[model samples]
Target chain A: MPLNISQPKRKNAISLTPLIDVVFILLLFFMLTSSFVPWRIVDTPLSVATDAPAAPEERVNVILTLKQNNGQVWVNDEVLSLSDSSVFQTLVSDNGDAVFIIQAEDGVTLQSLMSLADRLKLNGAETVSIANAFAMPEAK
Target chain B: MKIAAKYAARKANDDDNMVPLINVVFLMLVFFMVAGQIRKADPIPVIPPQSINDTRAATDPNIEIVVGADNILYVDDVLFTVEDVQAYLEQAFSSAVNPDAFWVQIKADGDIPLDSLRPIFNQVRLAGLTKVSLATQLEREAK
Candidate 1:
């Protein structure tokens, strides 16, 4: 028996097998690597400085306290706005060798404290230390 | 006519081939290894405070200590009571090549009180890990 077969016609179709595979792979790669929280680090003043002995030499010390309840920073008896750079400038000018003793109440964010400390450092304060040691936050 | 008959007679062998698939998978695996760090996720949600002068560290932290909301402590995403931290650090420091040079990163929530973080610092100090650092992100203005 003789079989007569017509040659198959070429169809205009692009193969998507590789393309689909690549798209899936790329999707999976991003899903695995992306973190819900992209945590970064900023170190604040030394909290351990509370244990260190007091300085032998009498140097200027500016006290700043953070009351978490009020969400305001206090320098001595006066409330200070963090927005003002001149506050730091005035403090630094008063005593070039001044040290800022920053004390924050429980539940205050470390980020805000660190920024203030950094600002002090930038304004020429030789040392900015956490005045009080860390402890368990008061159960509120 | 002979060539067409020959081609039709043999089954397409390439349909069963998986070489390209395997190659693509291998490349993806390598990309994940190189492009990302595999650090454990912090159990509690923490919004780290921002600072204008914050600087990114040159190296990844050797140890991760997270202070979550409600004053809970986490060491490398593993929950640790305040009491357990000293012992844990003792082990980490003892195993390190340079105990004194060992770097620590503290990731604390913005509102985490200083009192809540004190014990962790003490524990870190007791372990003789002097090179302690607090982790913070860049301020939005800086970003």
Candidate 2:
């Protein structure tokens, strides 16, 4: 009589090494990209209405004020010299859509404000809002 | 004879089947590279002020005005005087649609003077823009 022989079964296993490598690479890429991104810092007063906050569409606030000496003006805290066209050019170069909020002083001349407004209009600031400090006591 | 045939078949296919793995890795690499390319830069660096309750989500393609510790102003990375800011906004408004939909976010430092922010608000209104937002960090009280 001839002896019968049986074949051994082979196990199919999924390889995880490639998947893990891909995941680690993706994680590293995100970490590096996030670090290079610029961050913005702003200082502002608190609002009373916690229930209704400003919409996301309206978030860029351009703080404008005049310096005490020689009536030199500062926008968002940066002093501007009238002779420099670059300053005005830079203001208009913002690619992102941002709301412009003008916070002028009580005694600030309208002429200065108007002149600045004209430039902002050229730069693509679609929505510009004026903030009246006197109207809101909380702002003080 | 059956056992010998089965073993021979198993050994025939085991020589470095890494082509498929390489193909998948390369595909993912290309996918991430394309995705990373589309991200745009933020116009400006704005650290919003802290609020007891800040529930506002971040907006996309929005303008940011950052107020530094020394009360310095930056609009989309460019430094401007109060007058320059107004002029910039005015220029921006002429070409914008509805002029009323534009949103300006102000991120002011905690120690900055309240008086410093006055002119910015004034000019925003003058430009005919009504939508404005203040950025702030949410305060988490210690438990």
Q: Which runs in model 2 stand beyond 4 Å of their true positions?
A: A1-15, A29-140, B1-46, B55-62, B77-81
TM-score for model 2? 0.41
**Residue-by-residue lDDT tens digits, candidate 1, B8-103:** 445243433544765676676666656666655567777776655546677777788888878888888888898888788878878988654678
State which candidate has the highest lDDT.
1
TM-score of chain B of each: 0.67, 0.60
C-alpha TM-score for every candidate: 0.68, 0.41
Calculate DockQ per candidate and list them. 0.30, 0.05
Give one digit per residue, the lDDT tens place, for model 2 in B50-90: 33333453553245567776667877677877667767777
Can you tell me which runs of candidate 1 are displaced by over 4 Å?
A1-14, A35-59, A69-71, A121-126, A131-140, B1-40
**Please, what are the lDDT tens digits per residue for candidate 2 over residues A57-78?**
5466566554432335587658
RMSD of 2: 16.8
Model 1 chain B: ten consecutive residues of lowest lDDT: B8-17
Pairs of residues clashing in candidate 1: A41-B135, A41-B136, A42-B135, A42-B136, A107-B113, A109-B110, A134-B118, A135-B115, A135-B116, A136-B115
